[model samples]
Target chain A: MAEKVIAGRTIQVNDEGYMTNPSEWTREIAAEMAKEEGITLTDKHYAVLEYIREKALAGETLTIRKIGSSGIVDLKEFYQLFPGGPLKLASKLAGIPKPTSCV
Target chain B: MATKEEYPLKKVLIICAKGNLEDVYAALVMANGAVMEGIETKLFFTFFGLDAITKKRMNCLHTATVGNPALRMPGGLPFPTLLGILPGVEAGVSAMMRKEMDKLDIPPVKEFLEMITAGGGEIYACKLAADMFKLKKEDFTEEVLDIITVGQFYEMAGGIGTQIIFV
Candidate 1:
């Protein structure tokens, strides 16, 4: 485990840069991590992020196509927004662990 | 069984040997999960698995009702295997399953392939299976990178930390 300091708060992250503790997350930390991942947080990004965060907190697995059908963005926009691995990257940016299920 | 840390998998090779909707989706789901976890992933289609990558037949896959021990009714009732012999039963079951998955917003077979590739996953069809079916390269969707032999499949699975999963 590695520790990263975002917004002057130290938090543990896995080797893949996902937060180990969800309770330690803040919007500022998300912004910082998104920057590190070469993404700028937009309103659209926030929409997806918030949705994932909520679903994750409720103990639901999130998936790329599920998010695409969320009425927030389509699949093409999701791929465009998150690039390499949309659901994985988005969940990491949302300060959550990678979902174990498929989309 | 190997411990997780003992096999810090670098890649996952999923072998889709059955073309049944459930079987193909199982392979797809696992490969998609691997790519999401930052592991390199590839799907190999063989036997009936060709139905998943073939452009004409991919979307028309049916559920495997006969001999499916896991099949059950909605209320946890075990579905009798003998009933699977009914002509329309398999298709009906498949349609119901697809409807449930659609409600969860699961992508269809084609879009599922696209999503996996977009996440840096690769798709391959087995050479012998293709040749037996007389399938030209053009018969498959563009997402298929190549039709390869089982030896080549072994080679693809040869690297350290590579795991071959049969589904």
Candidate 2:
């Protein structure tokens, strides 16, 4: 584990940079991480991120299929929202643990 | 101390030569998973594996109840090969398998292919197998980009950090 200072607040993160405590996340922190991933978080991106964080916190297994049916963005749009490894990147940007799903 | 270097796979060429439900799903899941990971993936179906892309048979794939020793009853009992010979047993087992996979949010063959293509993964069918089975281009689902020979497939498979998998 590592302590990362993001958006001027220190947060606990795992080795791969996923926040250990998602409750520490903020829009500013997400914006900083999104910039690291070369993404510009729009309202559309935030909608999907928020939806995913909610499902992930409730212990729902996150998959591309589940995200496609999320009604906010379809699978293709989700991929475009966070290009490479969408679910993984989204989880990290959403301040959740790295996703372990393979689907 | 010497440290191991990492060379992640950049491309995957997956070949599915069997038509069984498990075989086709395995290929699809791998291809989909790879594409989702930002790896370039090409799926090639050959021999009976064409059933996975064939429009009429794609969604109705059957598990080999008779020969799959790993098959089991719902309660984890060994599924007898003799019982597999009963009429409709294979269909029932295949349906059960689909249901279980659905519970895991796994999609049917059609949607799986769609998901792969939507993510820019290309799907192909073996030319020889298609010719032998009298399958035309139109016989396959639209997800199949083309019917190609092994030579063409290998040509595309050539690259650093590329691996070819046969299922």
Model 2 chain A poorest 10 in a row by lDDT: A75-84
On the 0 to 100 scale, the lDDT of residue B48 in model 1 is 86
lDDT of 1 by residue, B1-167 (tens): 97655768889999999989988999988987777667889999998899999999987789878988999988999999889889999999998998898887677899889878876789999999999989979999999999999998888887789988999
TM-score of chain A of each: 0.92, 0.97
Give the residue spans of candidate 1 off by over 4 A.
A1-5, A9-27, A35-61, A69-86, A96-100, B1-7
> Which consecutive 10 residues in model 1 chain A have the weakest lDDT in total?
A60-69
Docking class of 1: acceptable
The global C-alpha lDDT for each of the candidates, from Candidate 1 onward, is 0.87, 0.93
Q: List-wise, what DockQ does each model earn?
A: 0.42, 0.81
Question: What local lDDT does model 2 show for residue B99?
Answer: 98
Per-residue lDDT of model 2, residues B1-167, tens digit only: 99999889999999999999999999999999999999999999999999999999999999998978899998999999999999999999999899999999999999999999988899999999999999999999999999999899989988789999999
Tens digits of per-residue lDDT for model 1, A22-91: 9898888888988988999898998988989998999877777777668998766777788767888888
TM-score attained by model 2 = 0.97
**Native contacts recovered, each model:** 0.42, 0.70
